[model samples]
Target chain A: MSVNTTPMPPERLLQLDDVHVHFSMREGLVRAVNGVSYHVDRGEVLGIVGESGSGKSVTARAIMRLLSKNAIEAGGRIRFRPEPGKEVEISSLPRDGRQVRELRGGHIGMIFQEPMTALSPVHSIGTQIMRTVMLHRRVGKEAARARAIELLERVQLPKPTEMIERYPHQLSGGMRQRAMIALALSCDPALLIADEPTTALDVTTEAQILELLKSLQAEMGMAIVFITHNFGVVADIADRVAVMYLGRIAETGSVDDIFYQPKHPYTRALLQSIPRLGQAPVRRLKTIPGMVPDPFNAPAGCAFHPRCAYAVPGRCDTLVPEVSLFPGDQSARCHLAGELPEEAL
Target chain B: MVGYITKRALWAIPTLVFVSFISFVIIQLPPGDYITAYAAQLRHGGEYLTEAQEAAMRQQYGLNDPILVQYWRWISNILFRGDFGHSLEWNAPVSSLIWERLGLTLAISTLSMVFTWIIAIPVGVYAATRQYSLFDYLFTVFGFLGKGIPDFLLALILMWLGFTWLNMDVGGLLSPRYESAPWTFDKVLNLLSHLWIPVVVLATGGAAGLIRVMRANMLDEMGKPYVETAYAQGLSERQVVWGYPVRVALNPFISTVGWALPALFSGDVITAVVLNLPTTGPLLLQALKMQDMYLAGSFILILSVFTVVGTLVSDVLLAWSDPRIRYA
Candidate 1:
């Protein structure tokens, strides 16, 4: 194959190709991320939207190679393009080895959901942030401290200098989240994976954090894989959205394609469930009927068939739906999503 | 933080006093008095004391005083004048005898604690990280064996091994060579050489228990999201294991320090007797058997103080290390 004349090489920062993550227990194996595939471009915020148990966090953890011992990556490849120069295989990287250590905070960084428990209780904010700075960057203590203060200020923390001396427990939820963000950005990583970073915060703080992440991503030009179950958050921040259902991507498209032109029945039900502001109150809010099928005992056909309103009676129950391209350049996995009634649209 | 430690230290005084008082009452509860034991020994030797002679002896020893008054006097002397009454067995000042033995016990206990922690922490952390691997399984087996086997049996086994395999003396802190040159390097090394068997035996059970505690604590800490966060922050596996979980696991281990202190300080009475090392544990046991109230009471008081102080120190250290902890 000849080298193609493609501009910017599509700037694919991280790509998961047909990834499958499963958990083996005494009972059975749970297919957590079943054949999930997606690509995060440089400086782009890719939102993984789904309800609880949709494998959004698992997908993010798989990218970072932070899965538990029970979690078996049955099949798939996670490749991280650190910069314009080289692409590294994340799945095959030797954990606890020197090579993985070098790449961890140097090329990739991660922020967890709960800030209360994320930071070390023993260390002060300054020391924790300084540790990352000194670890990756060959900087002295004084320089790292200065950089830590600067990073704290950049994260919109109050009194960055004084706050640095205080421990994580001394800070409120928003402050701790900011400190976590500061720690993540300290090494100037090429990829930032935020796994429900604002879920534990209040609504107002969540908005501020999301906005902070967006502004920071724009300034740093780092590809971010933002994991959340909130569709409203995806609407406000995602460049592209991947909707997960029963450990598989039911739909993947541009934000508009997902929000305005949803082609998957699961995605449509999720959008309908969102409590829209200014809408008249009703006896019961719209909800996707039935719960997610247990991952361990998932159905042989489409996992969403039991709950999908647009399910084709025999086909949806017997045949596993393949991921197929829809009309508006959107990808969906459903037997009759393209043939929905006009009024339902 | 220093102020917090100081406050904790101050609070320990009252706690120690209460513990000492209870220990004193417990010691006094037994029917036979120190004078009775002395009287029985005299009778065994066929030197029967007349009623007047026994009364004079009791008066001289202040044995006729009420139990509460005697306790108050003993406590007053210890707290105010630093005098710990004369021992009925050795006829030497109880404080002096206790101090000499205490210095030796302190050295052994300190060495054992250092050795146990150095060995246990790493082993526990390893077991936790490996979970059910071969190394973890081996340590778990060893840990259970350590916990189940009696301390005295452990000492006897060590002593037998020392005598048969190593051609070593199974006894006390020093060899006969130490009497000539007390502070020489050779004496110190010789002392340590003899000191280790008992210390190792005494510390083994504690170390094993600590390893189990540390393993459980580390496993718990490892499950905490903070540990995962540390790994996600790109810290090395060593950093995550030693840095995050180890520190948090210290909390449980620190609380156990109080319980371990007296056990360590005593240096395992059976081990001391089997090895013939004249540590305070065997001496205290002998004192109890002979009903040398002053000797036993003073030793018990010292041990109580040590237990109290050791716990306080660990608590303060824990508070200092953990930012979430607050001094009340």
Candidate 2:
């Protein structure tokens, strides 16, 4: 994908080095994202699973530098490689300057959870898509319009010519989501950040959208940073999974490693919480104790200590747990990550 | 869209009839008829008209009939014969007096409305974009001050300052020399010179209110996900703002088009009186005060027509501009 004499490796597509996003609200400084780090190789699907207030979406926004005005990337950097041998430090760019703006849809397109609100209510889906194609592709209006119809067709919308002229309100919920996906894929960004994209969709529609995204990612050969709260979605779509909790990565491993052999307490708890068909004897679903800690007054030591069932008293509360490595590149941030027995976990 | 417009227009017919009835009833709700107010005025001016003369006057003006019959006569003349009855106090046909001042009133109101928008929209946008900055704070203060100051008082101060410091002829729509002059380039120029004073006075409160409205609307729209989507499209901040939020912010502006024409006549009542401008505000005020039912009723009916027409235009524009509203 490089236009240079020397080609760089595809593994370096995107790298987050100790990313810290803090919001300075009136109450206090909220560490919404405290030192998050992950990487996405070209054409790889990385699922980030977390509950509400887990900072997964915030972390994805930090990657695109699309945080609120009160928010600041307190420290660390986001290194993005749009093409081989062309590295850009996204965290250093201004929030809305030309450089960051170029990095936005031109190189790193994003889609939100609510497709209803993501597309402009007043603008036609065609105009919304055409503007992107025209801006990034530098094409004429007619050509841009043609590309918009092509995109709508590619996303499997019937009667694309009619769809192009229709506004967001005229379309069904699922159709609007598909149109949003089309708009995001307009310029073919190397990395796509989908923040709970399927959460707002019904199950059948969500499955269709997931299938569409998977096929599109394969065809386009672009990396996807798929952020969702659904573990089931992660198992079906992701090759790799990064479980986040309380603004930090609790664990990062392959789908098999996360689902079958989770190293973190939070991940284990999460997996057990998912209702299985034959687990009727345990009729009550197991829920993680307590809630995600408030950002204004977070738990000391391990951020997840307060909610961690496997947490050791003084060791977990007094000292912060560092990342513990495991076999097959699996990693977890917990004091007793490797020491716990399989039965106990 | 054409069907929608036609439907809205048809709906306004009943609205006009209902409004006309309310206006006529309310106009007559006072102690006595126009003859009573006129005779009281004559007595105050030391010209005593006996009860017999008053009764003769009432009969001549058709004011002694049943209220409904009187209403039917007044309305039928307006609808069938294009007559607005007679202004008992002014002693002239209501149509003649209204048509003469209607042009100037429309001009002033239209100009002031335009001026209000032209100034307010940009300032509101700037304030919202640079929210909480010194410029935003300054505009906040400016908006509050503008909204708080009474239009008539502002006109008075501006007039005094114009006469004393600038030495400009400040009040009235035209110079005394051109007051009775027929339509000419010079008279038009003279009218324009005095026009800005009342326009500024009338627009001040409106612009101030609209600025805050635009700012709040823009702020709300700016927070929407579509704005972020626009930014993610690699559009410049300026493009993202103007193309997305600004258009949505202006829906309220489009809705205001329905009432704008009537506000043109009614918006400057106090300020026009203070400035002594030749507009319909004072005439409406006098017609109401003197219980000149025909003149008052005609004014309200004409305003109702303008309102109905304006609302239809506004509804069409709004539906065209916002599809969500069209469906709604």
Please tell me which predicted candidate would have the highest TM-score against the true structure.
2
Cα lDDT of model 1 by residue, A159-263, tens digit: 999989989889899989999999988888988888889999999999999999999988888888888999999888888999998888999999998887888
Model 1, position A59, has a per-residue lDDT of 87
Q: Give me candidate 2's TM-score against the actual structure.
A: 0.93
State the displacement of the C-alpha of residue B193, model 2, in Å, after optimal TM-score superposition: 3.4
Off by over 4 Å in 2: A1-9, A277-283, B25-72, B181-189
Encode model 1's per-residue lDDT on B1-328: one tens digit a residue. Answer: 8888878899998998788888787667778676676788799989887878878988997878997787888789888988987787887888888777777777877887888898899899999999999999999888888888887788788778888999986566677767667598887788877877766876677778889988998888898888887887778888878888898888887776776677666667776676676578888888889778778877778778878887887787678678888523
In model 1 chain B, the worst 10-residue window by lDDT is B319-328
Go through the candidates in order and give each one's C-alpha lDDT: 0.82, 0.87
DockQ of each: 0.69, 0.74
Superposed Cα deviation of residue A7, candidate 2 (Å): 12
- Chain A, model 1: TM: 0.93
Model 2 / residue A3 / CA error / Å: 28
